[model samples]
Target: MRFRIKKVINNNILCVTDADGSEMIVTGRGLGFGHKVGEQVDSASVQKTYRMTNPTVQQKLLDLLEQIPYEHFLLTDELVGEIRKRISYPLNESLLITLADHINFAIKRQKQGLLYKNPLLEPIRECYPEEFKMGRYCIKRIKEKLSVSLPEDEAGFIALHIVNAELNTSMSVMNDITRFVDGCIKVIESYYGKKFDHTSLAFSRLAVHLRFFAQRLFQNGQDSGKEEYDKKFRSLIARNCKEHYQCAETVAAYAENVWHKKVSDEEILFMAIHLKRVNLSEQHSD
Candidate 1:
């Protein structure tokens, strides 16, 4: 797996190949040690450059460089320059590359019958009163695109694209965490159930809420204590969990199908962690 450097972006390197390749961002301190633009990276060194969860994605990055071993800086700017026109945040070069990587991998995944399965209702159904139709909405659009519903992570990826374009790019500027929460609520409630304990419901709801809370807080130029937000979000999740921690598994089932970057085991485990923290804190004094 040898690849040529297609672009040198400060500490973030990117390369392209003959077969559609992902624009991988090389990360690992000193991995860039003495590397220059257009230099062909040996196969062994390429493995040391980055650690990505997706093996196919890792190979794609390597392939891109292997295919195109030499590049001029002007070509790098040219690609970015073209993408910038359509992208909301080109200056956010790293995210731009991430999105490109996602798109390329998604296409390949599609070829391998690995489409995402948007788990909109399986988990929410147990709760019953949430009525989130996004699962259905996503299912409809996804089926139309692929002749079948996409998987959860794939749905998450597509939703990310929609969320990015509809609200704003620069997830930092994104303030729609509440909207995502509301969307989840609507999807759950839309299912055949209509009654849920507020406490049980809040756990999943708060989880959705906090997904973007940190970024929104920073974007708004506020001096927010993440611990403070974590406390609140946790309190809500715990009250819900104490009533029914069992539902956390269901919520995780949905998350597993919805989100891609993190596995469901991780998501469900974090829910417990958040709940435990809440039990200890009780409540922060004003």
Candidate 2:
């Protein structure tokens, strides 16, 4: 397909439009070196083309392309490839823009000797281990390619970006979910009078559960419609596991008061079961 250059972003990047008027960002070595507006680009010269359907995101990418170095964008593209290889979940296309912008700013900050710590790093590591591992890989690649050493906190930040893309949510919403998960964990610990072993599988499972639980809470997607089997299971757990069930109730109440979302009975039951497993695991570990 023939592409007409609408704007030359850089020597390697061009903002082009097809015959149907759909805008695309095409990148290749020297693709835009001698190209001007309204010039037809050889399709063979285009190495990569990104079609951003969202106008706002497309504009943001265009603005970012103008500001950040093309190398940073290429580095992000490499990291994105690594992310896809490591996880099977569908990632939002906005990851390209957000992650590239993040890497650009991070490199700039490192040059300025400004180190910002991610507060949710611990929770993120415990909840999203796969994405966090990819984040580490991203920094390792940055160090190899650009010789810039980014802190582990940056890895956490990158993981959150991946999580945001996977959930198709905004960074603010992810922040809220992280905080909510942290709060729920605190509530569980307070009720149990013990801290969780962060390295344990049980804690990891609980954190993962609470992370998605918070997502549903903030998204107002609490379970609806009770089933007879679900009702029986909730009753059985409430009777057999009173302490864990009570802790779950406290967590539900905490969610209701702070997040203003009522946890469904099925959700509470599941929380109680997870809590029981966590308690049992902790006891066995001790």
Candidate 3:
């Protein structure tokens, strides 16, 4: 309950330790303005307290807090609050530092007229709709608070960060997953001889499925379970939806070649079913 300021990060942030010697980073307006080492942090002055157990992560956050503007951390705190309200999943606490660092850098880039387009923007938007929506909210908040109008591409980049936090994975892994999803979608488009309707629910569903498929492939190294009922259902799907099943086969082949992992029949069957829905949705839209 009581915190002794071990170090002052800024006028608004303090690195403190509780009675049990657990380190925590506490933040609030002017919380550290007149604070000194070994000083007790007024409980009322603390608005947010991040209990950092990982020493590496704690150090990274402390470094980030020192380097970036205090207001960026405040903005990220607000964004993380909004994210918790919308998302039911437990997010990695590292999101606080990473998002704040990203926002600060993005604003610096925008001010300098350096705008980088995110190549995975569409795939990200389709695969992670909720996170992408939160990314847009992040953009809106930055514009309102910092007066920086970042490109929509930045929203996709921010969405990836949120996805990384949600999955407790690295950014590179998320990038790989998005790229794999995009490649699989391209294979589907090639098989169907047409582009997908990005806004369609079927396309969104397929994208999400492929995203998780890739995540599973990377994390679990393929599903090898082959139940009799699963085999029967796969056969039934193949027999009923020949064209879509073939498309799914092509996607499976693509995944195998790229990831060097065998795709299970269950995975292919699900892919075929998704393809069938997408095909029907495409026809209806046409």
Candidate 4:
């Protein structure tokens, strides 16, 4: 459908108003070249349409496009298209615009030698293996096309963004989820009076479990399972691994206090086992 160009940001991009009266940013080579306000854009010439509903993100994207070279958008289009094709999960459409803005800024920062490290990189890789792998792939493509070497930490950041989109949650919500997971880890550490190896496979599994656990808690308010066998399994764990089970209880207590919802017995059982394995691994390594 044809849209009226509201404003031209540059030769390659323009802000246009759709028939629904909402604004959308359209991008294509020479799409805005000689286009002016109140001008009709030939619908067939549109290469990419960013229908982002968040005004703040849209404005930031417009600002980013103004500052960065036009090629960033082209690269972002191909990268996002490939990511959509490769990832099995459904990602939010907003990611198309937001990721491009992030990568463009990241490239600019990398070039200026002002790189930032993602402190959660290890946790992210351990927790979201598939998303993190896709993040690395995004960086590889950037390196190949743009010739910029972004650090591995960038992959983690990108993965988080993907997670955000997948969850249909905002960055703030993701931050809260991360803090919730970290708080649970602290409770486990305090109970054992020692730190578990974050790099250990068992710890990674625990983190991954807690990641989805927190997500479910936020999304649906509680975990879903009513099997009597699950209760029996948890009881068995409590009897066999009393100490780790106790630690898991403390974590469960924290969850209840924060979310006002009791953690499922199945969750506590799985967590205790993971904590036990991780603790044993750490002691052996020591």
Number of the top TM-score candidate: 2
Candidate 4, residue 217: the lDDT equals 68
Pick by lDDT: 1 or 4, better one: 4
Instruction: Provide the overall lDDT of each model, using Cα atoms, as 2-decimal numbers.
Output: 0.43, 0.90, 0.87, 0.82
Comparing candidate 3 with candidate 4, which one achieves the higher TM-score?
Answer: 3
Pick out the ten consecutive residues of candidate 4 with the lowest summed lDDT. Answer: 217-226
Q: lDDT, candidate 1, residue 158?
A: 35
Candidate 3 per-residue C-alpha lDDT over 121-190 given as tens digits, one digit per residue, 9 for 90 to 100: 9888877888899999999999999888998999999999988887778898889988888888888888
RMSD of each: 15.4, 2.4, 2.5, 5.4
Instruction: Name the regions of candidate 1 deviating beyond 4 angstroms.
Output: 1-91, 120-156, 159-180, 183-214, 217-221, 224-286
Residue-pair clash count for candidate 3: 0
User: Cα lDDT of model 3 overall?
Assistant: 0.87
Deviation in Å, model 2, residue 143 alpha carbon: 1.4
Listed per model in order, the count of residue pairs whose N, CA or C atoms clash below 3 Å is 28, 0, 0, 0
Off by over 4 Å in 2: 227-229, 277-286
Give the top-scoring candidate (lDDT). Answer: 2
- Across 152-202, the per-residue lDDT of candidate 1 in tens digits comes to 555344344434433345543442443334444444334314533444534
Itemize residue pairs with steric clashes in candidate 4.
none
